[model samples]
Target: MRIYNTRTRAKEDFESRLAGKVGIYACGPTVYNHIHIGNARTFLNFDMIRRYLAFAGYDVTFVQNITDVDDKIISQAKQEYGDELASGAMSPEEATQLVAQKYTDAFERAMSDLRMLPIEPPGAYAPRATEHIDGMIEMIALLIERGYAYEVGGDVYFEVRTFGDYGKLSGRSLDDMRAGERVVVDERKRDPMDFALWKSAKPGEPSWESPWGRGRPGWHIECSVMSAKYLGDSFDIHGGASDLIFPHHENEVAQSEAATGIRPFARIWMHAGLLNVNKEKMAKSLGNFTLLKDVLTQGYDANTIRMLMLGTHYRKPLDFSDSALDEARAKVERFANCFRDAEWAVRTADVSEPSEVSELARACDECETEFRAEMDDDFNTAGALGAIFELVAALNVLLKEKAGALPDADAADVRHAATVIEELAGVLGLKIRSNAKETAAHAGEQGRAALRLPDGSAIAPDEDSMSSLRDSATALGLTVEREEDLVLAVLDKRAEARAARDWAASDAIRDSLREAGLAVEDTPQGQRVTPILSSPRDLAHGSS
Candidate 1:
């Protein structure tokens, strides 16, 4: 495998520090407020990278840290609790804890809503900065002893000049960076580029007992300490957003290497590109930043959102637009339908064996190889997806030609092809479920029952109505056979409506099915009821 290293500024063969194990540490969110869509992209991209690595048979341990303690959290906490304090002004610990818990819960819920893979217990190991205060103090003490950091007043600052390789990761000369330094100038620092390692506690603010007096570890030092504590002084890969390369990541390199005396803190450094809106950087200050929930609530499913984010290569600037999302939705729908068709072929196939192998057979046989080739080259998800789409196209052609049934061998090939497509998609974290069937099965008794209107009226099962219904069944636990029966019954009812020329009822049912994630298409072989994956919005939630 190959990966682009931000430190080296080139793509290099990806080899873990250990033979078969890879440890990755990605900078996680600072729990302060609801994360915006841009933040979601960063998290999702790293998740994809982690998933792909594990998929390739590597023993991967992914670590993401939560910045529960930070300047932003402290300020926000003060604003939220200071006014409510009746007695002594709210303590920093009390306020920070309150805000951290609120936003941490919010971040967890957002990740769940986005359908991101769990980063705990079998997923990535998420560490809280506050939980590793001891580790931070130990590292800071070592840096000071090693003549790499110093203390001034109660605060401890990293002596940037002490580490000769200060700006290597960011490729900036120390003199050039100091000249362009726009950070608030601290008068006590030996150099203008020196940064805080431990911050002196202000009155009524959260602080830890450190040799440098009561203080909290600085942002850069926290990551270095936590990462080393969990992933050792050196690990396979370190990842974060490109924006962190300059100051945040560069500082990490300096602190970790200086404290541990390890030359390379991490073997590989990967950074995902930033997200933009209307060709402008998505920022809260810009007032154009959209939250992930905003888009999901607007009727896009997690799968569609994932498609939109992963459609472009991870290193390319992905412009978030409704048009791009729509295109992604269409592609997702197509992929889902292709899978459905392949499954149908397998189910309805009857021939004992094929005289000659089909094109789909070859496509399926080559999928893993082609997919791995694309991913091995810097995790080119776009190219990998192209390979999956090519197979999808082949399967579609085979299904179209072998409409009625397939020979036994042909059926086996088609089934293998379908499985390969799903396997490859899973590597990219694109779970291609037959949305309608899954929704119906998972939607539960109340959800399935709610398919009817309050007025006791019905029509083609539209996409809108079904989406609303499915949303209500989030995290549903049900049976596929039951959902299949429910969908089949609805399809039969629609067929009856059409046979009787009851256009309104037929259309309503069709629309409802479409909304519910079932693709209702009229084929020459009669009406084909294929479950189409729609957005996260309820099938009946906002339908007209």
Candidate 2:
């Protein structure tokens, strides 16, 4: 495996410091408010990389730190929970806790919605900065003892001049940094580049008992401490957005290495490229900030959003646009529909000579090989997707030649191909929706015989409506058949299983139906059946 190391500014071979194990720490969101699309992109990119690493047989211990205690969190908390005007009713400590939990919960939910790795045990562990305050204090104390940091008036600051490799990660020297410096520096600092290691708590703000008096850990100190506590003083990979390459990540390197005397704190420093809206950088001040919910409103599922994000290389800025999302949707639909066709051919094809090798089986082998090769080459998801699309095209060709059916051996080959597609796509966090043919059949039949949308919008089509839908399908070279009705019947049975507390039975039924190319979603009202569309759009539209 190869990953582009931000520290080296080059693509290098990836080798875990510990054999067969990868310890990865990504700078997580500061729980201040709802995360925007830029945050989503950074999180999703690392997630995909993490998934791929696990797929390659590494025991990955992924750690993402939640910056619960930060200047931004404190300010936002005051604005949100404090009383109007000068101060809030709640104290800074109380407000910080409230804001932290609110946005932390929201961030976790967004991760789940994006289908990223789980945040609990047996998945990625998200360590909160508050929980690791002791660790930060200990690290800061170590740095101070090593003559790398100093204390001043209940505050501690890192001495930038003491660290010989201060700007190595960002490839900036003290001279280059000074030339473009903009922020005002504290008069007490030994140097203008010196950054705070611990901040003295102001009145009504959150604070912890430390050697530097009652204060909270500085922004960079929290990450260094938390990452070392969880992933050790040195780990395999440390990742974040490209924007963090400068001050944030550079400061981390200085603090961690100064405390531990390690040459390199993390082996590979991976930073995902920033996200842009159209051609401009997405920012609140620019009035073009996009949230995940906003994209969902455009009829895109989390899967589609993820697919769209992964379409661009991880190190390249992606310009978010509706047209780009539409293209991703189309690609997802193509893969889903192709897999559905392959399954049908496998189920209906006659048994043939088992000894003979099938062309489709060979193609499946090629697809798997190609997919792995592409992924191994610095996790080129774009190249891997291209391989999947080629397999889809091949399967379509086979189905057309066989008149939608194949011999028994050929059917098995088709199934193998479909399974390979599903497995590979799953690694990319792309859920291949079932019942593509049905979804296609009902593509333009929206609101006809519709029960309800995922958002609670109702659609009831009577006899005339059904007739009109059928006419529209015919005109569009589609067929409205009993497949949908059969799907509903299966969903009804699955719902019964759920009602009876037969979770195993219900899950099995859902998987069985999905393999057969039908998407069965159990909504709060009842089971809603739809043609398997790639987008997990809510069923309220009857086209999810």
Candidate 2 structure quality by residue, lDDT tens digits, 24-126: 9999998887788888999999999889999999999989989998878888877786673245556677778988998887788667657788866665689
The best candidate in terms of lDDT: 1
For model 1 the TM-score comes to: 0.81
Question: Compared with the true structure, what per-residue lDDT tens digits does model 1 show for residues 110-222?
Answer: 67655677888564688899999998999989999999999999989899988999999988998899788786777899998999899998876789998888988899988
Off by over 4 Å in 1: 86-90, 350-356, 436-544
Per-residue error for 392 in candidate 2, Å, reads 0.4
Clash counts for all predictions? 38, 10
